[model samples]
Target: MRRFLIIAGLSLAALFGLAAPSFATVSEPDDDPLIDPAPCVNAATDGDADNVIAVCTPLIDQEKTGKPERVKALLARAAAFDRKQQFDRALGDYDTALMLDATKPDGFNARGELRRRQGNRPGALADFAAAVKRDPQHQAARANYKSLALELERLGAQLAVKNKPSFDCKQAKRPVQKAICADPELADLDREIDAAHQAKLRHAAAGTVSRRALLRAQDAYLAERNAAFGRSTDELRAAMKARLRQLRGGKAD
Candidate 1:
């Protein structure tokens, strides 16, 4: 169980690296806590605790009625993108819908699917968890909850590898083990990440990249990689992480 949690955590951390590769078929929601808060939840209510409650309750009891016409349009467009198997666009629509109205768990669930398709399992789990938490009775939220368990398991295993000596990049002179060797994308990512970690290590490795630098790279990487791979979030993230660790000199388990 602990192992699973570790992998999930690590993969989630690495997910943004390969997100541009594309994974739109995963069929989950795309709610980013970092980018934009849910619009429904973010609406400026009367500031009364009760007013806030009343505002949120409608999204559940009224069945998306709280969502504005624009919100609905965005969601519809996003759904259409899903139908066309254009996950990146679908994810964009989902983001717009959530930004327009955060109360819709369905939007969150839908966006989570896009993240999952992009190999962002941790993100998918977070969005799925958020969706169900906001509305326990939501069918989509319920389904997404069940969908994330496997992702969690895969994340855990990858995390174990992350913590092991076999996967540690900082300590490595050469990534000799085939078990440790990463794929092409991961290889590129590894080099990029290594550049970053090297700068942070001890006095900083020569030609090192900073944490701030990685943050910038992370954003572009997520959008680009998610659009590129289109693999199961956890699997793709795991593969990417192995390479990224090598690149960034991420410490092995």
Candidate 2:
């Protein structure tokens, strides 16, 4: 009976040893605290700026945290700073996030928008372009690029014509030309008259009697202006206005 009890005790010990390994395996830590990203993500999504900064900063500061988790923390804090109108801090975060991983379009797009608000158009355009290149179907980036490009084009055209006379100011040897170049209102009037006259010439058939008559009228007007400019500047301006009206099919007077 004592030998039977000893055998039973040995069998129980062997069974317990076999189960111990399984228990250890089950009890092992599933997630490492150093690299855990839940707190940063939650704070960014649900918390305000102050909360996000407080919660995410620790994760970002952790050296053991993976690049992906670090980027998330940085982006969250950046957005929080942006909401508080701390643009410089927000930019620093965005720069760090992009430097960590340039593949994400969201980072580029967000940075582009911030740069645009700061009036850094060139920087904004480059960022938007990078975002679009990474993800062609990125709607917001595409829209921003197209809208800014059109605005710049329109501005360029306006700037091209601004305060410019019909005749070149550099070649203004005549008193009338110098006067037109000197006064913005006179320059605008000169451009209008020249544009109207050119339009009439384009509409009139070449080598026809009407075209010949139009040319003659233009020559007469130029001769009269050249002869009258030094005498009465007001008269020259009035004559130019009247000529413009006539070219537009208005009354000759």
Candidate 3:
């Protein structure tokens, strides 16, 4: 029994001795005050960009710094770099901070603003969307997302109508109509001329002399375009431009 007790005590001592080094290793980092991010936070609050970077860089580089402290340091440094107009460095720090901790919406919003300033509209839109998705109450992110979305929507609508003519291309069978449908610029001119002519007709009283003259002028214009289109496309474009101008002038002749 005595020999068994001796063996058990020795085993317990060996186990504690092995764990002591690990405990010390874990606690040693906590003893170092320099690795704490308090100084970096203070510099950032002071708006002293150079001091923020100087203080935060060392904390960010230290492996002994905890993940939360490292993220704080990285964010502070990023803001400092932004104030200094060191855009690339600021972006790098923002990216690193977000990668380390993606739970914060402010980080995403900041990155989105940076991307916007860099003329990365699509990237900024995506980041703003992410920030809003993460926190619906984030007013800045929501405002940015809404503004960008409306701009894109307007641009999309313009592009959608850019190539469309007033008439349906599928039903066009005449040579001039087919030619107009085939060329985007000619189609646009034709559409504009038609719109201007229609507007003038709408303004004129029905059965009036002016309305009859406008109708005759439009018929004559179409007849001339159909007859001249086979000769030269350049002439067709010029005729269309002249017709558009005449119609827009609100003159019957």
Candidate 4:
């Protein structure tokens, strides 16, 4: 009896010793300063369930942290990423915010923009379609459609430019053999690229969109990327401007 009691006491002591440590260290989730609010969207005051606090919190921390002063910061950041051409991150933030609050037309619009920039035409179109559906009165969406129409015209222009012969260049450091670095005609080409890029940005900022608009945005982006063949900055500018005017309802003809 004495031996059994002693053995039981030893076992109980060991169990308590192990269990006490664990219990003492019990982690309080609320006490965790890192515990972000659920949804974890860039602009969301409270995060979303489709992307809950646990999963999205780390994503938010990795890309976007802290509550936005307003939705503006989130939108602006999305635009900046789209500008620097970081499409995936921008879309993640936008989608997260939209998931948190679908009523915010801007979130849907921005996600659509990122999708457009990323070359996800179908995704972008869907997002824009949703935005327009959510808010039919959105002016940005109206302007975006016009911009897309111009982009379609611009695609034709780009094909024409591609067929046009590149001029002689004095640029020695050109990476490509067929580059048009310093040609006098470069001025026009530069404008076209800029226009396409700006149109892309305008679409991103539109806060609403359409399928036609999404396709045009994609075409414009491709045109812009293809323009970088040691082309003259002046030419880039010209291409961009012409394209911009075209997007703004001007006839390229």
Q: Write the per-residue lDDT of candidate 4 for residues 1-253, one digit (tens) a residue.
A: 9999999999999999988745356666753355343333443333332233234445445434455422444444555555556667567657656755677766676776666666775666667667778898877754554565476587778766652333333433444323434343443454444455556566664645654575677576545646564434545445555665565567562
The C-alpha stretches of model 1 lying farther than 4 A from their native spots are 1-67, 158-253
Q: In every candidate, how many clashes are there?
A: 55, 0, 0, 30
Cα lDDT tens digits for candidate 1, 21-124: 76567656744222222443444222333333334334423433444755654665556557667788678768867887788887888888888888898889
TM-score of each: 0.37, 0.58, 0.57, 0.33
Candidate 2's TM-score reads: 0.58
34-96 per-residue lDDT for model 3 (tens digits): 576788889989999989989989898887889989988888899889989999999999999
Best by lDDT: 3
Q: All models: lDDT?
A: 0.60, 0.86, 0.87, 0.55
Q: Write the per-residue lDDT of candidate 2 for residues 1-253, one digit (tens) a residue.
A: 9999999999999999987866344565755367568877887778688999888988888888889889888888988999999999999999999999999888898999999999998899899999999999999999998887787798898678878888889988988888888878778778887787788889889999988998899889878887788745687778888888888889553
Ranking by TM-score: 2, 3, 1, 4
Q: In model 2, which residue pairs have backbone atoms overlapping below 3 Å?
A: none
Lowest summed lDDT across 10 adjacent residues in model 4 is found at 45-54
lDDT score at residue 48, model 2, on the 0-100 scale:
80
RMSD to truth, every model: 34.1, 10.2, 9.4, 18.0
